[model samples]
Target: MEVNEMAAEECKAVLEHASLGRLGCSYENQPYVVPIHFAYDGGYLYVFSTSGQKVKWMRANPKVCVQTDEAQNQSEWISVIVNGQYEELPGPQYTAERKHASSLLAKRSHWWLSALGERQMRVGDKLIEPLFFRIRIHSMSGLRFTDEKERRG
Candidate 1:
């Protein structure tokens, strides 16, 4: 098996095609990671979430990492890691962008269910408002592994 580094365009393609990733954030030397559904647009990854531990941590420390991948087999796989800064889009100033995010996310069915469900389970209230946030991509790197059979035909 041989592994290769993916170029910038390839990395963008991977990110564009992927909707799910592990969002990692750290604060006070503790790191937290969770699965997130996102929409890649322009230079940001728009995400939806309820006010939770990850949000609080990210608010304190903007630096974050997101890892996404596609795998066919052990040797046929691609993984991308992105370094970015978190920016929460909330309130009047970000009305347009927030709406845009809503539209993009609406493309996927049940997009709002997970967060709202979690909120309901925790607070036992359905009044919990959803939050929209974006990650401004600073850099990305990807690795792909290919075996002899894949490399041949």
Candidate 2:
């Protein structure tokens, strides 16, 4: 088996094809990681979630990281890591950006349904509110693992 560093374009390609990623945030030296569904454009990743621990932590420290990976088998895999800054798109000031995010996310059927359903079950309220946020990707890197014999000299 051999592991190789993926080029910038390769990393972006993986992000483009991926909709789910693990978001990592830190506050006061403590780390919290959560799985999130997101839409990737050129330099940003749009995400939706309710007001929770992750949000609180992100609000305090905008620095964040996102990880996404795909595996065909035990030995064949690609993993991407993105370091970014968190920015929440909210209210009237960010209407356009919010709409853009909604439009991109809408491409995936029922993207918002599960979040609302989870909120309803947890809060027992019919009026469910979810926030939209975007991560401003600063840099990204990736690694690919494969059988060495598959590549020719």
Residues 1-153 of candidate 1 have per-residue lDDT tens digits of: 789999989999988778889999999999999998888889899998877789999999999999999998766999999999999998899999999987777675254556577667888865456689999999999999889876566
- What is the C-alpha lDDT profile of model 2 across 83-146, one tens digit per residue? 9999999889999888888878777526464667676798886444578999999999999999
The global Cα lDDT (0 to 1) of model 2 is: 0.87
Clash pairs for candidate 1: none
Q: Which residue ranges in model 1 land beyond 4 Å of their true spot?
A: 109-123, 126-128, 149-153
Q: Show the colliding residue pairs in model 2.
A: none
lDDT of 1: 0.87
**Deviation in Å, model 2, residue 143 alpha carbon:** 0.4
